[model samples]
Target: MKRILTIVLLTISITVSAQTLRKYSNEFMNIGVDAAALGMANAVTAYSNDVNSGYWNPAGLVNLEDNQLALMHSSYFANIANYDYLAFAMPLDNRSAVGISLIRFAVDDILNTTQLIDAEGNINYDRISLFSTADYGVTFSYARKLPIPGFNYGINAKVIRRVIGKFASSWGFGLDAAIQFETRNEWKIGLMARDITTTFNAWAIDKDEFATVQNAVENQNQELPESTELTIPKLQFGVAKKFIYRHDFSILTELDLNIRFEQNNDIISTSIASINPAFGFEVGYIDMIYLRGGVGNFQNELQIDNSEKIGFQPSIGVGFKYSGIQVDYAFTDIGDQSVALYSNVFSLKLDFSIFR
Candidate 1:
């Protein structure tokens, strides 16, 4: 299983290099950051506030009431991969905010069997080694209120780094733009454009390391892979409304539309683009305890009988807040709906005002 997994990873890396515009390039970044957002099926674009906004919708950062920090961790594929996140944000003034976020997703300690066989065809288990493939992302965000009341805009400068043991590495850069608005009636709307300038990643492969891969399979991977990868722009639009009852209990519902330029299995597909809709709601009591649920990732799957079936993922979570500290937990399928195993996600938030 380990050998197969290693080969699969190498194959995916090479395949990505061969394509200039990959539909899912740098997808680790899209796995999301906060458990609360994930529990909502990533429908928090308009409702996001606090430090987690740095990843969801930077424009929401303008709502920060004080300096805040956030941390999150989740494991995928039955602990075969780990994802981690950290973020800090502060209100620069009454109408502006700034934030920084970091994320990492990695698969570690995979056995490297390419060197197990000697040139003379002698198999030596002692030659086996281990390596890891990891991807890192850093984002700097800024948001400011517009001259128009209830209007705000934000921008993100993102850096991406990916490494496959000592075999290959890449560096990438991208930009994002976002806006949020609130209506007089208390409706919130948000729009986020990711990779607005078209992210680019340039790869560097070590020939010495790649030579082993080339020889592993005859008539396969004999040539060097391409070195450039591109990520096209995507857009997410969201609207949310909160209903308060008797000033103590509240419910917030959100709907989001995710648009991609390429056609895929999305529920709404067209030659120009595809749209996937997500819906989530949160019930809160005195802003201290919360329950959340959502559904998303609509896709049409081909069944064994050559029939197509529509499927979606469902998620639920709970949150607690008190004295400037917050903790959230979510139970969800990180993969597609077909995945039977659900991953547990946890996140923590701290408000600096607590120390003051």
Candidate 2:
């Protein structure tokens, strides 16, 4: 059984190529959490004020005036994958705040091949199995207003776990830091460092489990061994401003720059790459409803092949607020229309202070 599982997982891992200069493992962490942010092409680093801040820019948590909770769910990768996020934040004091967040990405109902064949090499419907591949993360965040009036600083400590249908698993640890500054003229600037300590994922595979399907494992030429994947540091810088037309209307615009560094095989030379530049815009009506649109993921080539071509991923979203409850919806084109790669995300947020 373990052998069969190993082969399946190995086959999946083999699909990834070192085709991009910005190569980092566990890319799932890069996925945006709430519909509000995704709708804005992930340009919310400077303007994040909701529970989603726990994931985007922890410094924004200081903007929370009351205890709040947020939940999000999205059908991704043409409905083949599911992503879910949850977060809660509360003010620790006038100048400080704390938050907790959880994320889970999963693909389920995968066929269990080990049980698919009968003893005589014949297929038996009863001998079937199903499993899932998932990634999970939990984060704790702290934010405090700085002595510099409109400035704030924050940090996030997180643990990550990945599992491959009882075949392989990994544990990782990382830290993130952020700072935000609000200018007198409605402009906001934010800087964030992700995995500053260099996150590491230590993977473990159960070889003993493979004994059940020894022949299958032997043919794959895979020597089961413990290994680790490292994710280097990344930086994000953003600026946002709101143009208020009237007491009842305003437009918010934002831009974000993502910089990543990678080391060469010799470990002597390092290179920096700008992974993507994101842009977002939102229009609000009396603070009750919002319309958003944005584009991101600018690159010369979409993939390894030069002919693939690259184009911005565009997204649109709508949000409404009633009392202490807010609801948001987003429609995103995940690129490559031929593969049916679009997605929809929905999120709900609640402010407990309304009850008080």
Candidate 3:
């Protein structure tokens, strides 16, 4: 045990000390949009049920229940905007598939500010409690399953929309593809490419004319073109093995690797980019109960500041299912000292589906 721990710690130090930034942002789930990496190996992304497989692995859609729809919602603990996801898929003659999905970020409540210059260089303070909401991204997908035994493949496209409270919206789109392989009944492997054309156009930047002290820049722009034109999402490849302990009980362990297009400078952690490796295990006890836990960024350097990036992050979650529905929850934390306290994250997901 001591050897294992030592090796693990050594690996982490090396990873942190090593260089380069991977893409799709390192720990954005806690800081900003830059750290949101694609999730992996959740029960929601597990075997069997199917339906919303495209989000995790487009190829998984090949084996899902025909004609299905799943919608999930979660409220973050920090009183931030709620997170929402909706998925609908229909199998076409057992060979082809079509799907549509939407993910939106909505925040509630705001302290509206009023800027005024009174006579005699005197100013009065008046604040109005208000709320402004914004959302981005809509996806449309079409996939086909390969006839080869134990092999499945698919493709997808996403149209991104940037919407500000009531201002003009910006538009962009993305493309994705995936392949999955299975052997008899023992092992499963998957390779997925998300956001090939990760171009986020930032359009409505704030004009210097607005002297208001509020978040005018953010409120005025829905889609601002990135400084570098295009920043693509990192690529993820994973493998898993499943073991059955009983006729109705089973466990699965998976590992995922992320490689992005970020470059890291040895100093100050340019992108906090490092080869992120994650290990997760899932135990399904009976057909209705599921338990899961995982540590992200194990052996990877942990950085939470704006200058540095952290690719690997550890997370743990549990889920349960009854009939045609299921719910999943995950908790995550990263960073150090002052940043660590604010880095904790809680996520809730609900899946509802039916076969037509």
Clashes of each: 0, 2, 21
lDDT of 1 by residue, 1-356 (tens): 66556666676666565465554678888888888888898899998988999898999999998999999999988899999999999999999999999999999998888877778989899988899899999999999999999999999999999998888888999999999999999999999999999999888888888878777655555556547778899999999999999999999999999999988999999999999999999999999999999999888888999999988888999999999999999988645485446889999999998998
What is residue 58's positional error in candidate 3, in angstroms?
1.4
Give the clash total for candidate 2.
2
Model 3: residues with Cα > 4 Å off, grouped in runs: 1-49, 114-133, 164-169, 206-229, 264-274, 298-312, 334-356
Tens-digit lDDT track for model 3 on 201-314? 433423221223222222332222212223376566777888888679987788766555565432222364444555677778886776676544433234556444433345
Q: How close is each model in CA RMSD to the real structure? A: 2.0, 4.5, 11.0
Per-candidate TM-score against the hidden true structure: 0.94, 0.89, 0.70
The per-model lDDT (C-alpha) reads 0.89, 0.81, 0.51
lDDT, candidate 2, 237-286, per-residue tens: 99999998868998999999877775332212246554567899999999
Sorted by lDDT (best first), the order is 1, 2, 3
Model 3 Cα RMSD, Å?
Answer: 11.0
lDDT of 1 at 6: 64
lDDT for residue 304 in candidate 2, whole number 0-100: 62
Candidate 1: worst-modelled 10 consecutive residues by lDDT: 14-23
